[model samples]
Target: MNNTPESSFERCPVCQGSGSLRHLVTIREVPYWRCERCQCTLMDARCRLSPDDEQEVYRLHDNQPEDPGYRRFLNKLAGPLLARLAPGSEGLDFGCGPGPALAMMLREAGMQVRLFDPLFYPNHGALAGQYEFVTCTEVVEHLHHPLETFSLLDRLLKPGGLLGVMTCFQTDDSRFANWHYRRDPTHVVFYREATLQWLADHFGWVLEIPAKDVAIFRKPLSQPPVPGNG
Candidate 1:
């Protein structure tokens, strides 16, 4: 794809912003654009892998639940979230992937963890339940429609629930071209601190950045009144 603003054909998937994407950079001949409104970055759809190919790539991942290193990696999100939960709280591990390591960790802490992954678990029943917390570690970047995913998460949580997200954040436009995280073909959408803040503001959730790659959004105890609701 051409490295130009005119080449950004897709609307900003997060905020639905239009005509605001500028070609930010290209890497390995794949073009990416940045949304002016939300600061979310997107790869050209042409670069996305086919489902079979994507699954093949995922099959190569070394995310072994038994691996101590992997467990520690998951603790980055789980540690903070666990501290906030009441004893024996129920939670869902969204996009638990093949190993469901985070789910294992949470269960080990006495919290009940339901696992769901579009590719792996596919437990549609899990989607019907409310939870005290929901985690989506390293999963948001691959969402083709993050808006819908976020909406589902919001609806799935009980009042004052926590939504924990773990993904490497896009730090700067200049560094994007060579960023190792961007090299993954399955990773389509990218988030920045500002992009997550936009989500928090729009969804009436409180945002927290507990770590460099972690975002924790707390659902309000009561739904906020819509504009002009009085």
Candidate 2:
């Protein structure tokens, strides 16, 4: 039961499903919608930034690989993931940002990590290779096409592979208007805890909330049927 009227019906970008989306907030005159089904909050397509503008915003981030604070920030996702993996497993740091500090951290733990960032380190070969796990740290919010991006991750992982993601969960609509995370012009999507669970259920992956802002999903050994294959 969507509280908003049928006029708000726009297919959810994440799930590509029919859902009622209410106008959640308006920041700097940019409207964002919240889907009742998946609980995904997405910026209006008209409010999206141009490629050049997006790149410029990413370029301003100071997350150098050697920066101590940045390294600590990455450890939030890396530490738990390292503990779960088997010895010497290979992984991909998806959307590793310009610095790729998470890749560095994984390498330090004796795992082979390949880096891929659309802007900073574009390596098609890395995406083609299968990995035991994938890390997407602080990356999902900036995704313009999350369903495709996540499907790509699904294809890149081997059986029983892990997908670890870190992002500030969107909670409380009243607080959203002034939320710091939503202020970033490049962050176009927001996820609630339910949204993450919905993704796991949709994809047949096992979901776990390991820590604040961190969600881990493990792929089943056997692939599930495609949505319409039955």
lDDT of each: 0.88, 0.86
lDDT of 2 by residue, 1-230 (tens): 75432333357778776745777766776778887878999988887889999899999998889989888877888888988999899999998887888888899889999999988899988988999999999999998888888889889889899999999999889999889998898998899999999888878899988888999899999978646311
Global Cα lDDT for candidate 2: 0.86
RMSD of each: 2.8, 3.0
For each candidate in turn, the TM-score is 0.93, 0.93
Model 1, runs deviating above 4 Å: 1-5, 8-10, 225-230
Regions of candidate 2 where Cα sits further than 4 Å from its true position:
1-9, 228-230
Supply the TM-score for candidate 1.
0.93
Counting only residues 3 or more apart in sequence or on different chains, how many pairs clash (N, Cα, C under 3 Å) in candidate 1?
A: 0
lDDT by residue (tens digit), candidate 1, 70-129: 988889998999988999999999998999999998998999999999888999999999
Candidate 1 lDDT for residue 93: 95
